[model samples]
Target: MISLKPRWRSTLEKHRAKSARTERSGSVRLRIVAWTFLLTSFIITGLIFTVREILISDVGRGANSSTESEIGEFRNFAQIGVNPQTARPFETLEDMLGSYVTRQYTGYKEQVIGLTPHQIIFLEEQDHYALTTGYRLHQDQALLTGLRENPSNSGIEQTPAGPVHWGKVAVELRTDQGTTTGHLLVLEYIQPELDAVQHTVFIMIWVGVAGLAFTLLVSWLIATQITKPIRNLRQVAEHINDKNFSGRVTVKGDDDVAAMSHTFNKMLDRLEEATLTERQFMDEVSHELRTPITIVRGHLELMERTEEQEQTLLLVDDELERMGRIVSDLLTLAKSERPDFVQPHPTEVSELMISLDSKVQVFANHRWIIADIAEGEVGLDEQRITQAMLQLAANAAQYSPSGSAITIGSEFYGQGGERQLKLWVQDRGPGVSPEDASILFERFRRNNAKNPATAKQHSMGAGLGLAIVRSIAEAHGGGVWIAAPEDGPGSIFGISLPAPSPPKKTQSITATYPPQNEPEKS
Candidate 1:
C-alpha cells in the first residue's frame, strides 16, 4: 500500500499548489484575443450587410432620376422637329447641310443647299412653292419619302465612356405633305449604368480604409484591457520564490481575472495553513513517541536485575527494545521529511565504519568482509551516519545465509570540486529481485518470508530498519539506493555523503556492546 504520513502528504500538496502558478501569460492573452476577434467579426459582418443594402437602394434611385432627365431632353428635341400645336412638320433650313449631300440634289442649280433627299418636307401649309418647281420637288420628296421608311434606328452602345442603355418610343406627328413617311416621331431615353459603377467602387475603397483603421484601434483597446490584468498577475507570480508564498495577485474590477485572483489567494492561504499544521504535528508525534520509549528502556533496566520469572522478564525486555526501535524509526522519518534537515559536520569515515562493524558483530553470526574503509574524514552528522550504517549492516546480516560474508566499507570520490564518501554494505545471500529492490527501503517492507528461527527469536521488530536507514541518509543531504551486488551474488545498499573540506585525523571509536543478558524471548 502506498500511503503517506500526514507530514509528507501536506508537503506534496503544497508542492502541487506552487506548481499551478506557472501558466504562460502569452497563451492566455492569445485566447482572449481570439475570442474578441471572433465576436467583432460577427458584429461587423451584420452591420456591413445592412449598410450595403441601404447604399444599393440609394444608387438605384439616383440611376432612375438621371434616366428620366435624359428621356425629357429627347422629348423636347422631338417637339421642336414636329410642331405639337399645328401637327405640321418643320422644313430643314437651306445653309445647314453638308456639301456632299447637296451635290446629289440635281433638280436645283449647282449651289450648296441644306436640303437632302431625307430632309423634312412641308405638306398642309403649301402656300409654299407652286408647280413652277413642282415636278422637281415631287421627285425629291418621293426620293426622301423612301429614305425615311426606317425612323426608329437610333440605339446606344457601351464604350470606355460608360455603358449607355437607350430605348425609343413611337409618337404621332403631322407633316405639310400628305402623311409623309419621314414625319414619324422618335423619343429616346438613355441611361449610362457604368457611371454608377465608378461611384460604387470609389465609396467602397474609402469605406474599407476607414473600417481597417477602426478595427485596428478597437482590437488594440480590447487586447490592452484583457492582457493588463494578466500581466500584473504574471509579475506577482514571478516574485514567488522557494521561500515566499504570501504574495497575491491584485484584485482589480469585477472581471474573470479578478475572480481567479480571489480564488488563488484562498488556495495559497489553505496551503500555508496545511504546511504549518503538518510540520507541527510531525514534531509533536516525534516527541510523543520518543518519550515513552525512553521511559520503557528505563523500566527494562530496573526489572532486568530483580525479576525472577525468566519468561516474563524476557517478554518485557523484547517489547521494550522493539518499541524503542519503532520510536527511533519514527523520529528519523520525521526529521528526513523536513526541508532543512541537513547539518553537515566533519566526521572520520574509519570511526563510522568501526562503530557499525562492532554493532553488527553483536547481533550477526555472519563474518564481515571489510574493504576500502579509507582513513579519511567527510562532512556529515556522525550519529545519523552511524545509525544509517548500522541499519544497512543489520539488513545485510538478517538476509544473508548463515556463515555468509557481509562487506561494510567506504570510498572517497570527487564531485563539483568536493569529494564525496560512498559507504556501502553488501551481503552474499540469495539476491533480491529488482521489483523488491525498488521498495525495499519503504516502511515495513519485507522482501522474503521470515526465517522460523528469526520469527520466534526476534519477534519485536516491525521491519522499520531499512526505512529508518533511508530517512537518515536523506536527512544528511544524501540518498540511499539498492542494487544487485557487484559480484552477482547478493544485494548492495549504499549511502553517499559529501566529503569535508579539511580532513580530520582518524581515530578508533569505542567498541559497541550487546545487551548484557541474552535477548528476551518473544
Candidate 2:
C-alpha cells in the first residue's frame, strides 16, 4: 500500500467527516419525523381501543338488563302461579323456563338454562346445541356455589371463541305441599359484539396506517425543504474554507435559513475583498522596491574615489530619497484602506483656499492665482486635503511653462439636495487625453507626452503623487478627477469633498487677483 502524505491524509479525513455529518443531518431529520408519526399513530390506536371498551361495556349492561327482565318474568310466574300471556296456571318448572327462555331470548348468541343442585334440568338457545350440551352445570361447581351462596350473581367466562357474560338468579318454586330451589342462568356470547367492535378496529387500523403514511410523506417533504438550504450553506462554507469564495447558497423564502444564507454570502464578499487587497499590497511593494534597489546597487559597484565621487554619492542619496518617498506613498496607500485613515473635522473653505495659495507659490514661478473661494465649512482631514491639493499644484507647475497662469480655487456646488466642496488646480499645460486621464491616478503611471525641454531640465520623480492624492480623497469619502476646461487648452485636476452641515452662523470672504506684472524682456 502506498501511504498518503500528511496534508492529503488530513484533507481526506476532513472530507469523510463532513460527509458523515451531512448524512447524519438528513438521517436525524428522518428519524424525528418517523418517531413523531409513530407516536401519534399509537395514541390514536389507544383512543380507538378506549372507545371500543366503552362500547363493549354498554353492550354488557344491555345484556344484563335483558337478563334481569327475564328473571322478573319467571318470578312473577312462580308467585302468581299463572302465565300472563295465557291467563292459565299449572305449569311445571321446565315448562316455565322453556316458555320464559323462548319469550325473552332474541339473539342467536343468547341462551337460558335452568338448573338444580344435582343436574341441568332445562336449556334453550337459538342454535348451537353443542354449547348447552357440552356445558355441564355440575362441572361449574364453584360458579354454582357462588350463585347459591348469593341471591343473584353475574360473571364473565373466557371461552375458546371469546367471552361469555352470564347473569344468574336463584329462586324457590312452591306449590301447596312442595318447594324446590333452582337457578336461572342467562348467558350472552360476547363474541359477536366483540366481532363487530373488531371490525371497527380493523377499519381504524387501516385509517391509522394511511394517516401515518401521509404524515411521514408530509414530514419528509417539510424536513427536506428546511434542511436543503442549510446543506447548501454548508457546502458554500466548505468551498470558502478551501480558499474559494465564489460559491453562494440560493435563498428561498424569507426565513431564518434565508437570512443565514445572506449573511454567509456577505462574509464571502469581505473575504474576497481582503484577499485581493493583500495580493495587491504584496505586488505593489515588490514592483516599487525593485528599481531603486537596482539603481543603488549599480551606482555603488561603479564607485571610485575620484573627482566624480561626490556627484555619485549625491546621485545615490537622491535615489535613496526617491525610494523613501515611494515607500512612504505605499504606506499611505495601504493605510488608506483601513477605517481610521482620515480624522475629519470642520475646516472653513475660504481659509483652506488661502492656505493652498500660500503653499503652492514656492513650488514654481508660475502666476499662481486664487480664482474663487467658496465660503462654507466642510468636514475634512485638513492636513491630508492640503497634501492632496499641493500635489495637484506641483503637478500643474511641472506640466506648465514658468510664469504661466495656474489657478487654484474652491467652490460649492449643490445638486439634488446634496452639497460638495470642489478644490481644483487649473493649469494651461499639455491637456491629458481621455485614455490617459483614466489611469493617471494609478500608482507608478505617468504621461508620455511631457514637455521635452522641462523633462530634460528636472528629474522626474517617482509617479506616486497623483496616486497618493487619490488615496487621500478616497479616505475622506471623496474622489479626485481631471476635467478639461471648455475653452482653455489645459486640464483641471480637482478633488470633491462632501460638505459638512452648516453652522448656526455663516461667514463669507472674497478676494480678487490682478494680472501678474511680467518681467520686461532684455
Candidate 3:
C-alpha cells in the first residue's frame, strides 16, 4: 500500500464525496424505474396465471360430462338386449354382447372397453390399442373390478400420455332364462386439453418478457423527465457559487422546481446589486481620500518650525477632520441598506422645527428664523431626520451672506389618499443651476461655482453632507430634492416623507429671530 500526502488525501476525499452524491442521485432515479417495472410485471404475470388455471378447470369439467354421456348410451343398449345397428333381437348373451361391442367400435378418437366375468376386450380392435399404455390398461382393469364388486365406478387416472376421465355402468341382459351381469366402460382422453394449456403457457412466457422490457423502457423515460430539471438546478447553483450570477436555469413549466429557479434568480439579482453598491463605495472613498492625504503628506515633508509651517499644520489638521467626517458619512450611507438603520417613532413637526432652529445658529452668523412650523404626530426617525435637516441648514448657511436670512420650515399637505410631511431650508444665496442639481446628492460631488460666502468660511467640508441626507431620506422610504424659489433668488432644498396617517390635532409655532449684528469681515 502506498501512503498519500495530506493535501492529496484531502483532494481524493473531496472527489469521492462529490462522486458519491452523484451516484446517490442516479440511484434514486434507478430505484424509481425498477420498482415501477417490477410492480407492473407482478400484476400482469398474476393475471396470466389466473387465466391459465381457469382454462384447465373448464377442460376438466368438459371431459367429465362427455364420459357420463358415453356411459348412459352403453346402459341403454344393454337393457334393450338387441343389436343397435341391425335392429334385431339377440339369441344368446354372448351374441348380444358381441353385437353391442362391434357397434360401439367406430374407429374414432374415443375408445370403449367391454368386460365379462372371464375376459377383458377392447371394443375398437387390437391395432387401435397402440395409443394406450400398460398403465392405462391396468387402471382400466382395476376400475372394472371395482364395478363388479360395487356396481358404481367412476374415476380420473393419470397415465403416461396425460389424464383419462373414465366412467363405468353395470348392465343386466334380459331373456326368457334370466339376467346376466355385464360391465360397460367409457374413457375420455385429456391429452388434447393439456397440450392446449401448455402451448398457451409457452406463448404467455414470451409475452411477459416483452412486457417487462417495454415497462422498463417507459419507466426510464419518465424518470429522466422528472429528474432533468433538478439536475439543471444543481448546475446553476454551482455557477452561482463561482460568482457567476448571469447563468439561469430554463423554467419550462409551472412546477415547484420552476418556482425554485425563479426564486434563485431573484436572489442573484439582489447579490449583484449589493456587489455593485460596494464596489462603487470603495472607488468613491479611495478617490476622495487621496487628495487630503497628499496635502497632509506634502506639509509634513517640510521640516521647519516657521509661522508659515504652523499655518500648514493647521490646514493639515482641518483636512484630517474633514476626512473623519467623510468616513463617518460613508459609514452612515452604507448602513442604509441594513434593516435597523432607521428606528421610526411618532414625532411632532413643531418639535423638529424647534430642534433645527437651535442647532443651525451655531454653524454660521446668519439670521436663522423658523418661517413656519406644522403640528401633528408623524412617523419618523428623530435622530436621523434631525441630522439630515441640520446638514441642509448648514449647506444653506455656507452659501449665503453672513447676515442673509435662512428660513427653516415644516408643513403637512396632501389631498384624498396621498399625504406628505415636507421639511425645507431656504437661503438667500447664489442658487444652484438646474444642471448641477442633478448630481448634487451624489457622493463626493460639489458645486464648482464659487460663492463669496463659501470662500469666506475657514473650514470647507468634504462634499458628502448632501449625499448622507439623501441616504437618510431614502431609508425612510422618501426622497430629497433641490429647487429654485419661484419668486426669490435662492435655492430651496427640501425632504419629503410619506405620511399615510397624521394626527388630527394641529398647531403652529413661529420663531422670532434675534436682531442681526453683522461682524466686520477680515
Candidate 4:
C-alpha cells in the first residue's frame, strides 16, 4: 500500500471533483449536438440511397427505349420510304437493312445487324465505351448457335463485349427477286448503363460526406448558443452565498429560458428584502420593549425609600399601561390573520358612516366632521370597519391641534360586476414626511420620531394601529393606502374594501322594506 501526503491527496481529490463537474456540464451541449448530427446523417443517407436506386432503374428503361426506337425506324424502311442512313430508297430488303444499320441514330450502345438463312450479313457495329472487346455478337459462333437453337424475340447474351440485349425483327419484302426474308437485329450494350450507374453513385457519396460535415458544424454552433444561458445559471448558483448573492443572469430573449431567469431573479429579490426586514424587525422589537423596562428600573432604583412608593408606583403604572397597549395591539394583529377575524354582513354605507361619526366624538377634543358619505349597502363587519375607521381617526386626533378639523369620509368607485368602498380620515397636522411613508403600517414602527413636530405630539402607543387597519382591509379582500388631502395641509389615510355584489337593477315585484316598528337584532 502506498500513501501520499495530506496536501497532495487533497489537491488530487479537488482536481478530480472539478473534472467531474466539468464533464457533467459539457454533456448537455454534447448530447444536443450528437442527436442533431445523427438525425441529419439519416436524412442524407436516405436521399443518397433513393437517388442511386432511381438512376439504376433508369438504366434498364434506357435499354428498352433504345431497342424500341431502332425497331420503329427499320419498320418504316421496309415500306416505300427513304432510309436516312443511306439517304436513298431501299432497292431490296438487303439494301434497306444495310442502309438502316448506317443511320446516324445508331450509337455505341445501339447497333444494327442483318442475318439470312445461309450466314450473317450486313453487320453494322459502333465502338463501345466500356467494352473494348469490340462487337463480338456479330461474329461469335456460340451466340449464333444460341440464336439458331433458341431463337428468342429478345434476350440477354454474355458475349466478348460484356452483356448484350438483342432484339430481332424478321423482315419480308415483295421485290423483283421474289419475297426476300431476313432478320434485322438491334443490339444494345449493357456495360455502359452499368458504368453510368456506378459513376452516379460515386458522386452521391462525396456529396453526402460534405453535407454531413456541414451538418456537424451547424449543429455544434446551435448547441453552443443554446447552452450559454445554462452555463450562466450554473455560475450564479456556484457563487450564491448568504453574504454575497448579487449575481444575476442576463436575459436576452422572450423565450422560456428568459422567463425562468426572470422568475428566479424575482424570487431572489423577495428573499433578500425579507431578510433585511426580519433583521430590522428584531432590532425594533428589542428597542421598544427595552424602553419600558429601563424606565421601570430607573424609577425603582432611585426611589431608595418607602415615602416615595406612591410616586414611583404611579410612574411605573403609566409605563405598564403603555406596555399593555402594545401587547393588545400585537394580539389584535395576530387575531386578524384568522379566517373569522372580520365577519361581514350587509349594512347601509351611509348609516355606518353616521355611526362612526357619533362614536369618535369623545376620542379627542378635535372637531370631527363628516366630509362626505356614499349611499349604498356594503358587505362589512360593522364593528370592525368602525374600529378600523376609529383607529385612523384616533391617529389623526393625536397628531392634529386642539379644535382642528379631522375629516371623515367614504365613497364608492368601481364598474362592471362589483363596486368598492374607500373610507378615509384626513388630519390637519404637519403632513407626512417622505422617509416615514414607506414604513407607516409596519408593527413597532412609528412615524419619524426624530422630527420635533412629531415628537411634540402626545401620541404614546405602539405603531401597530395602521397595521391593524391594513389587516382588516385585507381580510375583506381589499387594501389600505395613504394620499395627500385635496385642498388641505395634511395627509389622508384610507382603507379600500371590496363591496359584495349589488342587488339586481330591475325587479318583477314591488320594492319592499322591513317595518320601522320592528327593532333590529343585536
Candidates 2 and 4: which is better by TM-score?
2
Could you tell which candidate, 1 or 4, scores higher by lDDT?
Answer: 4
Question: How does model 3 fare in lDDT?
Answer: 0.72
lDDT for each of the candidates? Answer: 0.57, 0.72, 0.72, 0.72
- TM-score of predicted structure 1: 0.49
Off by over 4 Å in 4: 1-26, 81-96, 103-105, 122-131, 144-152, 155-163, 173-181, 241-244, 273-522
lDDT of 4 by residue, 199-260 (tens): 88888888888888888898888888988887787778666643345778787899998888
- Model 2, 82-133: lDDT tens per residue? 6657787644565555556556644566666767655554443433444654
Clashing pairs in 1: 122-176, 122-177, 123-176, 123-177, 124-176, 379-500
* TM-score, candidate number 2: 0.49
Error at 233, model 4, angstroms: 1.7
What's each prediction's TM-score? 0.49, 0.49, 0.48, 0.45
> Which tens-of-lDDT digit does each residue in 248-282 have in candidate 3?
77788898878987887788888877876785786
Model 4: lDDT of residue 430: 79
Candidate 2 at 188: error in angstroms? 1.2
Off-target runs (Cα >4 Å) in candidate 3 are: 1-4, 7-16, 75-82, 86-101, 104-109, 129-152, 254-522
RMSD of 1: 18.4
Residue 206 in candidate 2, Cα distance off native in Å: 4.0
